[model samples]
Target: MAAPIDRPGARWGVAMCHGFSGSPSSVAPWAKGLAARGFDVEVPRLPGHGTDWRDLEGRRWREWTECFEEACARVAARNDVVFLAGLSMGGAIALRTASRLPVAGVAVVNPGLGFYDWRVRYIGAIRHFLRTTAPIDEPAAPEPVGDEGDYPVTPLAAVYELRQLFRATDRALPKVTAPLLAFKSDADPVVPPSSMTRILRRVASDDVEFVPLHESPHVATRDREALLIVARTAEFFERCAAKAAHPAVGA
Candidate 1:
């Protein structure tokens, strides 16, 4: 299992969360990129992730979200400005966190809020009979990059938990007021485009920006447009940090 990544020394901190069934490796590059810029960065390995899929079978969304919340609290304690970045299910966790916490900003890529396929709705009913499902697809990355460590199988129980999380996150979206930076791949196979549309429409954030990735798939962090993602993420966090430090006095 890959260990968490932490870099210290800076007034601003970023807590990055990986997607479901994905380890910290998925977002390691993005964390390092921000750390290199001198901001404290932390990439936490979610509960039951970076390990056997069976370990994820009984875990609920609350466990995953709590782990992320702990990491955010640690980062926020040390830095004047703090932000959250996540992919897929992690994005849902981040949005949920932002609704309750006073984070400076939020950045999400290929956020999996809801699925278009009707099959997922029935997972809860059939999960007791089917323990696990086959791997969805082989990890794809650019030439020099290797696959980000992900589980070989999907746990049906965990999928049900994710569905529950999506419903809760959707309900909480109207309460998230932090500046948001959302990136979506036009060809993502795992998460449908509705995920992005729903977030944009429901989130109460006044400052929101969406970037479309034409060539990447679900895991855009490790795909061809990774550098662009790093750049935009850094730029967005910097902008948020600046605003937090020097807020306007009156309307």
Candidate 2:
């Protein structure tokens, strides 16, 4: 992944976190944009990602969280102000980190807490059917933006662990002090709108802002509104920058 931020004189550093079963390559455009805006960017490749699908068979949530925590530590060390941006599962990791770190701000895109309902339990059956008799349109699109195909079949054990992460982070939500910019899609096939609402309502900081992507699907980072995502994200971060530069004067 690129070093979190790259503007020669930029003071704040940004860490770009990718979703579960996704690699930094998928978040490249956002990282590049952040870099263009003078933020050092680091898109860390989570454990079990960017490798053969089977390599994820033995991996656990701890492996992925640790990788991001390490990246945050590295970025935090080099810059005076550090920010975070993540997609899907990466968003959860960003929240988890924000709860513990002195992060300046965070931007979350379609952060996945978990599947919506019990039917999620049937994912294995669905995967089997798709692999055997049916072929779903490759979850990652082709040509326009191809799926590198490094992710593994969803592991029940890992899913269970991710649930634990959600609960833990939910409890920590009210404690995070950083500013937040959360984005969710109206047509998302994966995440529910309620989850995004919950995050916005629970965070202790009143600096949280939510933007609904009306036309995109779950992966709004790669969806049609991607430019809007990038533009709005930069605008939000810039607002935070201005806040830091000019704190309110005493009455």
Instruction: List residue ranges in candidate 2 displaced over 4 A.
Output: 1-10, 119-143, 146-152, 249-251
Candidate 1 per-residue lDDT, tens place, 155-205, comes to 889999999999999999999999999999998888989989999999999
lDDT of 2 by residue, 75-99 (tens): 8888777888999888988998899
lDDT of candidates 1 onward, in order: 0.87, 0.74
Range of the 10 consecutive residues with the lowest summed lDDT in candidate 1: 1-10
TM-score of each: 0.93, 0.84
Clashing pairs in 2: 3-41, 4-40, 4-41, 4-42, 5-40, 5-41, 6-40
**Predictions: Cα RMSD each:** 4.0, 4.6
Question: What are the runs in model 1 whose C-alpha is more than 4 Å off?
Answer: 1-10
